[model samples]
Target: MTAFVLVAGAYTGDWVWHDVAAQLRAAGAGAHAAVLTGMGSGAPAAPPGTDLERHVRELVELVDEIGDPEVVLVGHDYGIHPVLGAAGRRPGRITRVVHVDTPLVQDGATALALVPDPAVHQALAEGPAHLPPPASREAWQRWGSTDGLDDATLGRLIREAAPQPPATLTQPLRLTAAATELPLTGVLCIANGSSIATVQSLVELGDPRFQALADPRITYLELATGHWPMLSAPDGLAEVLLASAKGEGRRVTRPAEGELPPHLRPFLLDLPERRRERVGRVDLYPPEADGPRPAVLFVHGGPVPAGVEPTPRDWPTLVGYARYAAGLGVVGATLDHRLHDLSAYPRAAEDLAAAVDLVRADPRVDPDRIALWFLSAGGLLCAEWIAEPPPWLRCVAAAYPILAPLPNWGPFEPRFRPAAALGRAGNRPPIVLLRVGGERAEIASTVEAFLAAAEGTAADVEVIDLPGGTHGFETTDRSEDARRAVERTMRAVLDRLES
Candidate 1:
């Protein structure tokens, strides 16, 4: 029988793998769910002193005790850290490494460093060493049921979930190129179609952590479920594992021709009118019409990754939104701003200004009928735009934008606060806030704060509540409601410019 060692991610334990393990066991394979020391029930919470080496030792010890000459190593979430480290330490003893949900860590970098958001670090510092689930019971149920996990199963999972020691995330992994040479399979969960696109894009861009994914020995599988496939879609996950055990790679189901509506192709790479800026490039997608078209300058979220060059995968989203706008009858242009590490707040604000000037100067664009579409973190840079409302600007649209600073995002300049700007600007533009209904608590608070500050201000603030929309609704949520919300948002922007 082929032996499998299963490692769980943060706030999880062996119990989470019970269903998946049983399926593998019934298939005549010996499967052992190795609960990391600081996770699972009765396990001592790992302290700040606990590091990746500690978990590496535990996994290596477990493999030796399994008594199998070679084992298939499977890791989920943060478990990828230790699993990869162990694979580096004992390459010959492992047949294949399967990573689910989380990417393999880069050498000399902690898992925490890879997370783009600063808020996550804040939460870790303020909270307990072992982190618990952030969502409520209802939210968990809502997010987990993408694969139809029943109420009873989800409840059991919630009850059994534990606090993951923060140390697990903060500790850097010790890895060499040897692990990349091992046969690898990636079982992607959550928004599986786009997730595959993202992974493939990362591979194409030569991201160090995902560079192995491009290797001929690596295979990709999509579970089409939530992040926790073990609890939600155990049967599907187990089947993938069984096939993987035989060195079989399942064919990824490709999206049908034109399945993604034409309107959603605003950020298509093939869009015309490209120019290079100092920080990055900007692509302009003009309306198909002949005369001067109303234009909108788009800004993407992220202080993305520091020190890494930007690639198509870096801003597939902003590219898409820009395409969507142009397809709807306006000149849509997407801007790639300098990363936080390379440039600070005002620099991004300056880049946005330059993109606007470039788009306005275009003979095909109407300078008087321009607007701004800011997504996520990019919305923060719009504080200056809001504070000093331009005369020709018609409106400002933001989708799930982080309007307020939780600090630590450089200087909290007055321009960082949009609400205050809305109140002071003599010529406030109509603002359309695309609020995601199912947003998390922290983001929800930021949204409410922005709205409250905008109250009684001169700005004509309009809130478009996208029911059932996730954080990155455009790319992630394909529900009818979300699609309609996106369509409505584009029409509003185009109509404002055209009028």
Candidate 2:
């Protein structure tokens, strides 16, 4: 019989897995909940020196005591650190490892480093050795969404929560190569804000960090509860865990090498290449008969992985658009911004601003007649320009752009919200938005929200809808409709530029 080792996240420990353990036992599986040091009811207070390694050692000891030949090690939230450490040390005993509502942390990474709130980081850096759990029911939301928890559960959670040792979070987790070789399963709690589709989208972006997710040995399952799925839906969680042990869940397949992802396919229009010049980080394609001509600067979407080769400036669609703009008697430009990840939006905005200044300073470009075109995730960058359009900025265009952050992004800055910015704007540039019918639901919702917000604004907004197109349709959808839409969009932007 397969044995299961259940681990709970911060604060409460063995008790958190009680219900799930019961269900697992009823289903003919041996379930053991390993309570980490400095946690669980009646557990002794941890010393300042009690770190992640100590907790990992505690879990390793439990596995040794259980002495099960086939062990399915399950980790939830903060518990993953110790679980991974133990698995790395005993790879021969662990058959499969399951991660519940936690990120895939790399070796040398600390739990505190993954925490999004800067205030939490500051407090942890300067505060006591032990961090107290939430004092009030409402405060629990900081850890994760409290969507499905009942009043009794919430009350009990706060009452029984233990102080988390600061060292446990700050200490790095070290893993051996054998741990990675074990089969893995990820359980995402959608109500707390993540789903299979979200993972697929990140993988689709060609982010190298997520490339391993496509391996057949890894599987994904979703629970429609909050972060504490064991409390909210214990039976459901048990079922998923059983299914995971059997290697039954959705698996994302990676495209073969030399095969293009939907987003990287060939551009719809095949335009002739123009004279290209590298202006610092920006690529420029000046029109043939140009003497200080109007310029269109294209910003490609992505918190693209920093190591992605060829860069956004060299992408086929961006190059195609730049060349197409040059054909329209305008100076075309494409730039590489530093939106390396979700947290680097401010830096990306700064990079884009610097690129804009560089483009305007060029002697061959008409600085006062510039248009900005944004794509995909780059749409968020449009918020600043739309909120306060400079006199030189004539028009703005976006192609299947994400105007708002997805729910999974978690507590993004309000300043990056283009929809909200549009609502508060006075005078703005003419906006040309290309909407794709078959766009991903998350991205499509943002586009709809942007349009809804635009309805209340005085800013001139025009939407060109492609009834049969998908996100990144310029390359993915090779239909004649997509080609016409691309042509129409280009013409519309050029008309505004020349106006």
Candidate 3:
């Protein structure tokens, strides 16, 4: 007796949900495909004033009219905005809220802010009041992956798609506390680069922002299809929705209370602490007998939540490595960059460059003998330095880094791929790579690709493999091999710095 309200993302309408709705109805559930104010077959061209709030009102009115005793609300992509707003207004009536292949956007966040493409940003900012839908397959890929969709469905989508109102993208979504309190389900599109494992990894980072995702009330289901699952796998999407209503999807496990996540655990190597000095946003651990010694700048990986406490500079692994480097007769520096999320890479790269400048300018460090060490997600930031090494730069090092964007990280700039950048280097600095045997397949594949790209390059590429290590192995593995790998990698970096 549960009634389902289905909402489609930008450029589509109720038509996009037709197959799913039919399947839902055949299974004895009531389904309503919502047609927003500026979309669908009979609707007029979106007016200048058509915004998010207008769409919310439309959904609210539909829910009121349906008056089903039990109601489940489903939202896909851009459709999540109105679904959240409407749920906020009618919290008591909504049984559960399902997010389909979209991020859980916070209050007052605009879709424009979450999108990573600069071209999309420009189009929404300076183009027409209503942005037109994709005219071809290439353009569609920019919006989301087109995997699993046949040519007929792709053509139908292009021909029937509606123009998106600019205000819908730019306007902020407002939500109430009661709405967030409702039971939630997330249907992740794995082929589009997100899966239950990805969500679980984020939760394991111990970030407060992702803590709520571990709550038992939240469930996750993986769809091995493209972003538009309703179009590509309608029956599967319908089944998932039904399962979601029954609270049957997998739940992400949290660390036991008072226990730290693996990344936050103490570093495996035991090293004496050195006197630490703070320089702007950088933390310096200068060697005791330093006479303008060679420096190694450590960059921590993220798309870490901006609000996460202790920050990356203070992470046990970074702190431990910095202190250990100081013990080896070099100035070791750790920096706090602005890589707060996927979209902030450019700003994060700029912050890292500035930190390098700050470190080189310090009187205790040798400006011409600096080495850069990158970790985890921070690995992509090394692409620029590798592509065009500065005369003063001596070496580049990365540990368990993502060298290429994941398949699901849609429409990324080609310049950020380290594997591709290797081909563009003229006088590249020596490269030291630390590969983990037990790393996630997605990340491990990126490292393998980078290695293949380095096959015949003039650069001196040395790889130190940890046979039984995981990503963030310094704290997670805690084995003899892990300690030795860390030591070997550090020694290799020092060799390049002192050369």
Q: Show the colliding residue pairs in model 3.
A: 192-408
Worst 10 residues of 1 by lDDT: 261-270
Ranking by lDDT: 3, 2, 1
Per-residue lDDT of model 3, residues 259-370, tens digit only: 8977788999988878999977899999987489999999999888877778888889999999999999999999999988777889988999999999999998899999
Give the Å shift of residue 54 in candidate 2.
Answer: 3.2
Please provide, for model 1 over 1-499, each residue's C-alpha lDDT reduced to its tens digit, 9 standing for 90 to 100: 6888998876677778888999998988889998677777656667666767888998998887877665999998778888999898889889999987666557877877644334457778885555556444554432222234676876776777775667778877878678868888888764322255445434433335545556678777776666678888888989988878777774323234556422233332234543323324567877777888888887876555445554322355666666666777788788676645423777878777888988898898888999998887677777888888788899899988878653222235677777677777887878888998876433565678789878867457878888787666665566677777877877777777777
Candidate with better lDDT, 2 vs 3: 3
lDDT of each: 0.71, 0.86, 0.88
Clashing residue pairs in candidate 1 are 266-323, 266-324, 267-319, 267-320, 267-323
| Ranking of candidates on TM-score, top first | 2, 3, 1
Cα miss at 71, model 3 (Å)?
3.1
- For candidate 2, write residues 1-499 as lDDT tens digits: 7789998888778898899999999999889988777887646679878999999888889898885668999998888989999999989889999999888878898988765545567678687878878777656776776667999999999988988898888999998888888999999887666778667767877788898778788999999878899999999999999999999899887767777776677777888868999978899999987489999999988888888877888888999999999998999999999999898999999999999999999998999999999999999999999988899999999999989876446567888999999976777899999998877665777899899888877668889999988767777767788988988998889899889
CA-RMSD of model 1: 9.1
Between prediction 2 and prediction 3, the one with superior TM-score is 2
Model 3 TM-score, all chains together:
0.81
